[model samples]
Target: MSKKDTTYILNEIRNYLDKFNNASDEYYSFIKLSNELSELRTTIQRIELADASIPYINQLKKQYDAKEQAYIALYKYIKHGLISSWYETNKIIKDIGKISDADLSNKNKQMQYLNHYKTLLQENNNIIKPTLKERIAYSLSNLIRKR
Candidate 1:
């Protein structure tokens, strides 16, 4: 994923956690983190192929998967009232699981994108070395021209 996107996701996750209450924080935090991770997964899928760093991408994917599993377990525990509300927590867990699973498939797409970006980079090294500012300018010019 792009650094900006990653940072955005991390910020969102942090924001969600910051608002968590110890009384119900675990459940709420898990749900928020899961949702952010799912969104990151989607964003990652879109740019994985464009990134030059495979190891980094893989690392992020692994981290996201771990977090997802953690959230799932937290949800289960909350659902059972092992730590919190049973019925309410169970309902939230079920909802999060359904949406999270559907969105989880994007991780595979991110792997594909990563591979594609690697290949493109290798094949066109001469054209991909512009500084970030230059790239942004070029993209903006193109956008403006299109408009």
Candidate 2:
């Protein structure tokens, strides 16, 4: 994928993060975030398929997986009525916005930023716990599945 495409995806991620901050509807915020993440994932997949020889693709994939996991946790929280603060994510978005095309062109620098961003998201995930509603929902789902 071109740097322009990556930059656009990053911008979309930033926009969604900003929306998540002030949005009254948690479900809408979660859906927007999910779509942005999907776009990012698709972009990464295209890059990997285009050039499997790219040494940094694995690192990028790892970062993407971490982000997906973290976001899944965030979604769970959102579904349970526990709205997460986007302060840390917004900071990461600002850092991403500062990344120049030169930085994006460099595999090591890109990996470094991606790894750091993934870590920040993971930290936020660790801080969030599923609300009682989520636990109850899970239990109900399990019971229904056993039938």
Against the true structure, whose TM-score is highest? 1
Regions of model 1 farther than 4 Å from truth: 1-23, 82-147
Q: State the lDDT of candidate 1 residue by residue for 1-147, as single tens digits.
A: 444543444353344334334437666787798788888798668668687578877877888888888877877555433312222233333333333333434566543443343344345444324455655665676589799
Reference-based TM-score of each model: 0.37, 0.36
Q: Alpha carbon lDDT of residue 35, candidate 2?
A: 83
TM-score of 1: 0.37
Residue by residue across 30-141, what tens digits does model 2's lDDT show? 6877887788788788987787666677777777787788789877766534322444454555556566655555666544555456556656654545566655776686
Candidate 2 Cα errors over 4 Å, as ranges = 1-29, 82-147
Lowest lDDT block of 10, candidate 2: 79-88
lDDT of 1: 0.53
Model 2 residue 76 distance off true place after TM-score fit, in angstroms: 0.8
Worst 10 residues of 1 by lDDT: 82-91
